[model samples]
Target: MTATLASVPVRSRSFAFILGSPRSGGNTETLARYAAEGLPPDSTSGWLNLCDLPLPAQPAGPVPSGAEKVLLDATLESTDIVVASPLHWYSVSAATKLYLDYWARWIALPDVSFRERMRGKNLWAVTAYARGDDRDTEPLTGMLRRTADYLAMEWRGALLARAHRPGDLEADPAILSRAAGFFDPRD
Candidate 1:
């Protein structure tokens, strides 16, 4: 039998939801939250809204900024990192891009050992797009998959939803239902 997310003990796993949506409580966030519902009640879930904590366009070289440190700490502490970013212009939002850019700085910091630490961590994505098919979200997915490969992190897959309006996802029972077991460990 396959072990599910809920079957895993709390101490062995933690989740970090990095919300990169421009607005809070959007479709992508909702989808990710639905998937998170499958976790055990005692699980540690760190919800970081990129909209609230924006990353500066410029990196502070090797020294991390306050916001960066907050994000960095969460990233390092999690066993799973769910990037909940809406598909903007067929890709991730600006805030999400900036956050990913910081990874380069983190890798070059000499003392941070960011890449080494990220190894074996699970990387998941939740993205919603309008006016297109699955191919539209492929670029975003590819980027994330490549990132996971580069870091030696496990590519745990993605939750892609089609949402044009603010509440489109909430109205879609099928997508929401799929989300319920999105994190169930697959063989």
Candidate 2:
């Protein structure tokens, strides 16, 4: 007798992560955790660990692969999104860049526009850099801003932090405080 595998239904959550870096104990993960702390308990959140997912290179045709569609769908369904990343060569990590490239597929879909799906969605960025210089984050911030604008998502400010070494963010009180403000904005 052959047994068929059962497909578990995926949960429809209100929040999700578009994580850029795959490394653990990095600034990106730290920042994501901080931002998540402020979210209401009832809201469901999913972390799309970029390292675990197999995102192929950009396709040549108009239709995006099934994998790309799933990713876009997950983000579109979320009410609040946090794009977490660490600075790589003064810009976002390659993993995050690949994911963002897939957005073009969503834009090409007829009757379901990328702008419409992302409209009114609250979007925030969290970037970690090794340098204390605040300007080091300009490239990443600018890229994120442009991407958010293209997607028609609302820009909800960014949380930037500096860490000299791995796990250094834990010792930075200023970063922690800034993170708190980003997650729970008083104004």
Candidate 3:
């Protein structure tokens, strides 16, 4: 994946790296963890693995709270947001997909400000597939980009890693460095 970002003037840059793989030790999670290693020292950053959260179905309230709220808040508060997931048959993992589905509910809230709040943030993605071909990830990337467009966020590209098994990314020093450098402002 290319390591680049939109040339926007970030007032207070921050990154929220999210992991949506079902396996806590999955390659997607590994890459995301390593990628966040290079975040600017002064930037606010956090990593949330969605596999650990409970996606309960509930109607929206005045102030959305809990995991969904935390994630939405982080996505809004940060200048950049990284969404990482393992491609599950040309689509994001179930957890990631479901988390995104919450956007629908959030937008329907009584005092919904979800769309307005998400405007202009940079949305990045990190995904992996056993196929070892970037082509397999195109659909996912397109979905992410379209989602960003729909939310009025910016699509800042993606890291499409190749992993045949767990810990594969850890074995490639060059890829590991590139992954981490995604967040490195110094390049």
Candidate 4:
């Protein structure tokens, strides 16, 4: 029940991609990269693998430091935010969920208009799953839309692909076409 990616007019925009899966070089990462293919190198902020960073102590605890902070900084400056995660129990991975949990901290950071900064920015969800119930993607998409709504950001729909294993996307012509056409500016 994942929503089809809207055929909106494409315009070059800075994007910071967050890889939510813990497995390095996995299909989720590959799919996210593919979805971003239309964005030029300079327009893309590059991918940040959350699995490589330390998780915050608690949801209400202080924000993460070092690499996580750098990721946050990049996100703060980006025009769009893309969250790429593998389906775990019908939802995003622990890494992606925890990273999002930290947003509460940003919303409360004193002297920093973090939430305000996020306002008006576009939020996109990208994920891949196995041959299981693709219907599982529905709840996750709802969660993303709600999150974006709460943050006052625009919900830009999602690019969902089914890949049982790494490199499987190579055979998904529909997904490949969707990803390839994502950034092409149309009249």
- Which model scores highest in TM-score? 1
* Candidate 4 wrongly placed segments (more than 4 Å): 1-12, 40-42, 59-64, 184-187
Q: How many clashes show up in model 3? A: 0
TM-score of 3: 0.84
What's the ranking of the predictions by lDDT, best on top?
1, 3, 4, 2
Deviation in Å, model 1, residue 21 alpha carbon: 0.7
lDDT values of the candidates?
0.88, 0.76, 0.81, 0.80
Of 2 and 4, the candidate ranking higher by lDDT: 4
> How accurate locally is residue 126 in candidate 4, as Cα lDDT from 0 to 100?
85
> Can you write out model 2's per-residue Cα lDDT over 130-163, one digit (the tens) per residue?
7757698888888878777877777877888887
TM-score of each: 0.90, 0.82, 0.84, 0.85
Off by over 4 Å in 1: 1-11, 40-42, 185-187
Tell me the lDDT of model 1 at 106: 89
Better of 1 and 2 by lDDT: 1
- What local lDDT does model 3 show for residue 133? 87
**Alpha-carbon deviation at 116 in model 2, angstroms:** 0.9
Q: Which run of 10 residues does model 3 get worst, by summed lDDT?
A: 53-62
Ranking by TM-score: 1, 4, 3, 2
| Winner by lDDT | 1
- For 1-187, candidate 1 gives per-residue lDDT tens digits of 9999989874557899999999888888888898989865556788999988888888765678689999989998998999999999888998998989988888988888999999999999999888788799889999999999999999988899899897898799998888988887441
Clashes of each: 0, 0, 0, 0
Instruction: Please state every model's RMSD to the true fold in angstroms.
Output: 4.3, 9.2, 6.1, 7.4
lDDT of 4 by residue, 1-187 (tens): 6555686555567888988988887888887777777775557566788877656656334554686677778789888899998888888998888888878777787855888999999898888889776687988888999999999999988788889976788987888998876654441
